[model samples]
Target: MTRRTTLNLPQLRAFLAVVDAGGFSAAAAELGMSQSAVSHAVASLERELAAPLLIRAHPVRTTVLGERVLPHARMALSAVRSVEQLAAEATGTMTGTVRLAATPTVCQGLVPGLLRHWREDQPLVTVRVFEGDSSEVSAWLEDGTADAAVLIDPPPATAGSYPHPGVQLATDGYRALLPRDHPLAEEPAIDLRDLEDDPFLISPNGCEARVRTIHRLAGLRFSPTHRVRDLATLISMVQAGIGVTVLSEVSRSLIPADLVLLPLKPDTSRRLVLTGPQNRLWHPALRTLADSAAGHLAHTASCTAGPAVGQPLPSRSG
Candidate 1:
């Protein structure tokens, strides 16, 4: 007779919680377990796997092995949940996890409300949001770390394809964000030339494509005085009078009370795209989420100033 060892579901659960929460302490709080117990579970798992899983960096970086194992673990968990669902089919309950990634701006301005709505509608489904810049979000989807992503100016499908394929969640035009007292704030609308010499705050290098397009269309070089990664940070800097920045109508919700959003001349626009693996069918809960996001954005656009100051841009619908 051959000896066999059973899999430790509790230990695996603890490890996944730590990865999702970004640290042992947070994982413990989320799982309602003692921090020491969480740590011990992870230690036991590491001993079993014979590999160090996570790096002790702030924000809890995952090691290469951890990254490789993460997707498999998620899949295994999903399978287990599916079995439970089969057993509970007569009860007509839905439960699973959906992982989504997006730019910090979208995460802050649009996703929170959508997630809240999702929780109300699908009480059993867990939604996890990951925030990063455009490139990082795209990479997350490609690598299976995220099930889907919301992206602006998705890299051209080819070198020059406009409005790349996949599903479009929404469309928004650009605007100039200015401090309330700035000279250009009183202008009913703004021309690109008016911003030529203005000190500008802009998205970091990874998000330069659309910004570059605007600059190119305006026939000016984008010489931003400050480049930041998060839209909220850029808006805060603008509110503090550091510099004016260009923003999308969708970003209007993030504008501070002291800032004003003026429409840009020539009507430059961007598309928000929801992307995932081409062939995989989305879970019903995720489909509900995407539909809700699209509906909310449509409702917001039709009823509001489109990009009024102090309001976040809607994430879906034109």
Candidate 2:
């Protein structure tokens, strides 16, 4: 006959905690259980294994066998946590943190609006935001550092694309930002080639990628005389007549009063995208984020300046 024993989750956790905490009493306090309960759990685990897992002494410590099993126990606990999270996501009873990553502009321009709406809907889901450059944002999703992201679309669909599910959130076009007294400021629509000689400024969060893409689309040589990474600083520089750059209309709220935003002759626009891991159902909170962002964009589409882009330029009189 073979001896068999089934170990419970409580037994495994108690055993690991007692070994780590160096005592039953400490593990009990950490687990919110009585010391006797903690001791019983560990004893149950030991009986299941048919081995002496710990040595009771002035200061409790694990035995050699316990040391060997500890790593496996930890891995099991981690797997259990993953299962629990997936189940929670599936049931839409999302609680705890939903980690998010986004480009700097999205962090300022879109994330806040989405989160504000999310707060009203899913108050139990805590969202944590991490701001990065475009590539960094993608890396966070792939590396499991983030549960979701707000990004510009169309995503890099080439080989080595972000391995995840994605959706478009909103559609908005770009416009040029210049000082009110700039030479071509009076033009109703400005061609990309019109400002060839002017010094260009790349706006907050290293919007160099968008600048490069615009140059490619327009078949023009593009170079920024200065790169500005802070939104407020970029606005101040433009207001001071430092240089000109393109901005998404959704970002109009961040624009200062002294600058002028003009439509582009050949319009260029972007669709905001939301993405999550491909391996599992997006954490319920992440799904909510995508839905909330889409709904917010739709709700704000008919009117300018509610949440995302789609705003008509403000008059110079203001």
Candidate 3:
């Protein structure tokens, strides 16, 4: 079988230093080690290199193969040390900009408050935010465009192979938005069949695809006549009587005064997960920000206090 790993540079260098100084005792004196210690280093190096590094019979002669590998081993050792030096400088100091990608709903609703909460602890770490859909957020994480990300778990049909298994921070549910004067707007919850023939306005941004999927899975028909990309625009279309739409609790704060938000019957929901590069360690500030959002923001993103998904609309008075 082939030796599966490249040579360990430090061990190879120790073996070379022993070879240069002739005998193990003399090499130890020159390299600042005990003779037995120098001998053990060479033994370990030979095992990994899969080649005899020294002939132990006399004044430590390099084996024929060891002489052939000396130059390459020295260069590899030099390159490894250089990388170690640079990494030592960057590993823990959390002072630079950290980039993150998020969906528009998170970008507008959750991110601002998360920044404020994180800033008190990480005053020096400047966070830059970018907006995208769930797929874009996960892609940014895989490609190194983002240091971390906040995204909805993609709908099963559209999910991609993400680098890291996400840490779910929250679950947001869907709601139906209607103009305050819509005939059935005061209902506690909306049955999909109630609006089976009503004109639908699909929210192209946020979790629009999710709403569509829920309708499909429920075996209901949702023929949207108008499509829009902004939450405010999605609401405006409903307000102007263009059509009705479905939104999630994350977007509840953006709803207008004239709109009635009630839970979507047989409620559909999605988990919000935090994603980032799998192998890299997060800087101190970045980890703190991620932790804060995961620990605190998850609970607060829902519109629990209002007459939205969790409660019934007020009764209309004469």
In terms of TM-score, the best-performing candidate is 1
Candidate 1: tens digits of C-alpha lDDT, residues 1-318: 954445587887788889878899998987779999999998887887778988977788789998887877766665565466455555766666677898866776667776887787678878888888877887777655576788775653432221223445556678888999998889999998888878888877334677778888888887889888766688788888888878877777777778898999857877777654433334434554555555655666678865522222333332
Output the lDDT of residue 174, model 3. Answer: 83
- The local lDDT score (0 to 100) that residue 43 gets in candidate 2 is 88
Off by over 4 Å in 1: 1-5, 8-10, 50-68, 78-92, 154-169, 228-233, 240-242, 274-284, 294-318
Tell me which residue pairs clash in candidate 2: 250-309
* Candidate 3 segments exceeding 4 Å error: 1-93, 154-167, 279-284, 295-318
Per-residue lDDT of candidate 2, residues 1-318 (tens digit): 998789889998898778755788977876779999998998888888999989997478779998888767765765675676678767867665577888766777777877888888778878878888878887766655566877666444333432334556657578888988888989998888888888888853555676678887888877789887776787788888778888876677677777888897558777667777554345545655555655565667766655544322111121
lDDT of each: 0.71, 0.72, 0.67
Q: How much is the lDDT of residue 211 in candidate 2?
A: 67
What lDDT score goes with residue 263 in model 1? 91
Compose the digit string of candidate 3's lDDT tens values, residues 1-318: 875855565577577567655678876775567878877888887887777878886787878898887666655654554455356447743454567788887777667766886687567668878788777888766554566887676333212332224455556788888888988898998887788777888766566667778788778875788888776777788889988878777777788899988888867887666655554434334544555555454455453564322111121232
User: What's the lDDT of the predicted structure labeled candidate 1?
Assistant: 0.71
Regarding TM-score, does 1 or 3 come out ahead? 1
Ranking by lDDT: 2, 1, 3
Which structure is stronger by lDDT: 1 or 2? 2
Q: What is the C-alpha RMSD of each candidate to the true structure, in Å?
A: 5.9, 10.8, 17.9
By the lDDT metric, which is better: model 1 or model 3? Answer: 1
Per-model TM-score versus the true fold: 0.73, 0.63, 0.59
